[model samples]
Target: MPLFRAEHGGAKARPRRRRTRNMEWVGSCGKTDENGHVLSLTRLCLLSLANNMKDMWAKDYADNYLDHYSFRYIMGPFTLLPGELVEELTWLLCTRKQMSRAALHLMLVPQLRGLSLESCPSLVTATLCAHIAARCRGLRSLDLSGGQQLPSKVLCETLCCLPALRSLSLAGTPCDRGVIKAIAQRCPLLRHLDISRCHLLSPAALLPLGAPLPPLPLISLLALDIGFGEQEGDPAAAAAYLLLSLPGLERVAMEGLGQACCLIQQRQFNRSDGFTDREGVPRLVELWRDWRHRQGTDTCRTMREAAAREEEEEERTLSDGFGSDSEEEARRDGGPNCSQNQTEDRKRGGDLSDDGCLVLQLKDVKGISCDFLDSLSLACPNISSISVHVDDFENTRGESQGSLLATGLQAWSAQLRSLSMYHPGPLVNLLPALQVACSSLVSLTLEGVKIGPHTPLLEVIKACPGLRDLLISAEPPTTPWEAEDEEDQRAEQNLPRLANLCSLTLNFSYEHSQMKPVMSCMSLEKVLKCLLAGSPLLEKLSLVSLPCPLNGILQEVLDLLHLHQYFFADSTNSPLMPLGRVQRVNLLRTDVTMMTVRSLMQRSKRLKYVDVSYCWRISQVEWMHCERSTEVQVVWL
Candidate 1:
């Protein structure tokens, strides 16, 4: 039954046997099937050819291939290749920079539905756009995000041509009002649009689309990110208008709208009747009122339409001999029932509880008062993530308004999942509020919060038991008189077990010499051990700018790793296990040594990335040895 018999006779037989062994070895190298092997070979050959050929030669070769393939496919009965395959091939060429303008024109097939020339900045030209417009008519999604060189006119014209585009990202592009207008006018079916960082395009440009008019163009849009773009106009008003207009919008990112908060604060103070006193404030107030009225009107209209449809359906059911006498009587006597329905509809319309927007990003927007936040939450009650920067907690009367801010936070705390606050001022007044309000938080990031003797960081962490990610950048104490009595008292207490914590970043900045004495009182080493022991799921541990003895902590981690390995080697399970899941260790500017680093690498098999940049203790020879010895990525700069 054997197809071939092995023979060990002479040199010729030896050579044949070697060839057979080599063939077997090659076949055992990979587990891919025949088609996968063919595809891999094709890709490798194409990449090799592209790498060897010059730009012009590559373009010529691409043109020739497209010509031959299109001619044969159009003339013969052979089915064309799948669109995804063609798109992948194009993406490969683009990523390698082998896709020239001429090649791009030749490769714009009619079957292509999604194209991302994000990496090919040189090919994002007017002529190329014209080619795409002419050939790729069925393209649904396009990402020209980093095409800052593309002119607004050309972009507008291109977008106008592609009316069928559903998703488009022009982030970091020099898009202007005309281009946005073109999108509203032409691309009516757009569901996702990201124009973030388009500095030339102001928020005023979006007003027309969100205008209180019949047949809103971008009504079907689900996500819109215009963050860090415009700062000249009333961004808050524009944001509110968009939220009110777009009923289906789920995410809105409007970072760096600090000017809007400033304008709102100014308007709040200048509420006099004189025209000179209240120039722009009344307009914004009226706009708010109009938005509220419009929301109520829309809700009432929807309810009325539903009631009318129900009445019609009931009449039809009676005609079809499927309705009872009571239903027929209720339909005929519609005065009291109609009155009750109208009252219920009115009550529902009056309630400002919008559940449309789920994510709202307002990073670095200062002067956000409690009233503004309360009103915003009233309009968007289902917001889950928000980023804000509280510059000063004082009101216009020079009084601390911490309670007011807390009120605003409480309004939306029920649904808040992620909260990032950058408070340059002291958080003594706000920490208590956050402890109570943010118990439901899953991710908490606090930057620029001064950590003093009274600031209980542990208590805040304990409040949010479900936190999966926590980042705390603590500033040094402002006064040297503030002792570490509070921290010392809590040194013996154990941190609450964070069962879900996965990432933690603790940055304690000590710029002055006086703060060094204060830092000694805070038992950071004990705190670190407690946190590590609690967070068994911790994968990323970043200790930046900490003036503590990090080497001891590293040794503890190494010992834990040894214990974990010992238990595994013995094939037994222990009740207390090590942090065996840690994958990323960032000890930037820490005092950890090479011994700890080497032992860590040898013990933790799952360790992937280690950053020891600016670590003075790590010398050149040791850094090089560690980098060469381990497969783990080691960074030493």
Candidate 2:
């Protein structure tokens, strides 16, 4: 009989006691506290031993530890940790200078899914890639960007092994045409590929993908970044071929395509072949044009056949006495005719070959003309993000091309959600068009643009109600008085409240020299206060090279936080308080004091990153105090 008896109470029952295992509690405590400390200490000891192994005693000790104790005892606790933690530990170990061949072999486990050895010149060798290919067969993402030492042959062979790879970034690697062909032939399941800055890769490297008879097409590829790569042949023809062939591509970064597009357009308009004898440009252009025409013809033929079949089906239905007389009369009177529908479908399908492309990156591209932009718009009707350098358009050709560039931007403004422009060559003429057409813009970046009375930064903010991320790198005005006057005028105007704004960066650093005086309409305390007050949801605030002192700005933010708390004390509806969501504050090269840093840390509860590099006022002692007070990472150098 048990004390805890059944509900019927048939008999007396004994009470059930909870079981407490001392071993489980001891194991949890050891793994949580002692194991981490012991492992870190052992890793430090091992690194020291590896460095001093030239001595007789150190060599003996290291050999003994590696042979008898390292894997059996030191690595036993890692099994209890999660796979992600293990992978991160492996990456850290591999990046260290003390990492040897034996250590690398130990880290390459079977459960590894993602590995990034980016810019690790010492670790990214052909043998390392071979070892990864052999061990990490289940890997999904691999980033070996800037691995200049990795040989192309080994890379190709390594890619052939990892068929499960979904993302692969080989930027700045010396991959050639053969490697590109191998990737297209083997890795069909790849979704994102980045081969940017691969100077050895020619334009012909992508031609194999568009070939009629291929191993297979990269049908699952969604994003391709081939930007900044120096090509041997005609890049425009290759890009056109790719767009026509791969209708599944959603984002493409062709940073140097502006010059190539202009070249193609110029050649066509002038009926000249400037590059006919060089690099087989004429042959590739002809091939692309022919393929495009064939695609349109095939689409039209297919649509007509489908329409004919539909008409036949309707006539058969009428003959079977299932249709009314009114229906017959309407069909005869050309109401919703099948031919019209077919024609419309054919026109739409023929015009847009790469309608799936949503993002295009053309940074540092020059010579963008109107016809090329129109053609691009027709091909990719849904481009939402674009990064371009406007100075190229103004400085390379003339002012007319800049106007053409502005017109192209206007054409795309209706669909653009993110726009980034560098250098202020003709932004004065471009801003008005943007104000009217860019109502749907969610992110805008203007770098090296002069923001004065002419630019009117407030007007741009007001125009885009949905803007969430804004970055302005304004060059300093010629005189300090002008900047002060502009700031005063701006502070007088009613600041627009940006409820949806999450990130804001205002950089007033002169491009050539950092010691120069800060000059901008945004280099004042009142203007910053108004901006911060308007952005209630701001998470990241970066003020680089500003003239205004950090204490005043931080004080304003602290006051706002206190005011928000007081007002919302009794209200339970608001989940986020003002300035509470500020996670990152970058004050690079600005005049920030240690007191301001401490104040910001005390007020902003969720602040995680504080960058005070090049800040002259904060002493080491004060920095140590701020660092020891909280877990927030303070970057100072």
TM-score of each: 0.68, 0.71
Steric clash pairs (candidate 2)? 1-13, 2-13, 2-14, 3-13, 3-14
Candidate that scores best on TM-score = 2
Model 1 residue runs over 4 Å out of place are: 1-143, 211-233, 255-328, 332-340, 347-371, 397-401, 476-493, 508-522, 568-579
Query: How would you encode candidate 2's per-residue C-alpha lDDT over 511-615 as one tens digit per residue?
Result: 544553453434455557766877778889999877556566777678877777777775465455566778889988877788888877877766888999777
lDDT of 1 at 574: 40
The CA lDDT of each predicted structure is 0.62, 0.61
Candidate 1 lDDT score at position 40: 50
Candidate 1 local Cα displacement, residue 614, angstroms: 1.7
Query: How does candidate 2 score on lDDT?
Result: 0.61
Q: lDDT, candidate 1, residue 68?
A: 43
Q: Point out where model 2 deviates above 4 Å.
A: 1-107, 119-122, 202-206, 212-233, 255-322, 325-371, 392-402, 426-429, 451-453, 482-493, 510-527, 570-576
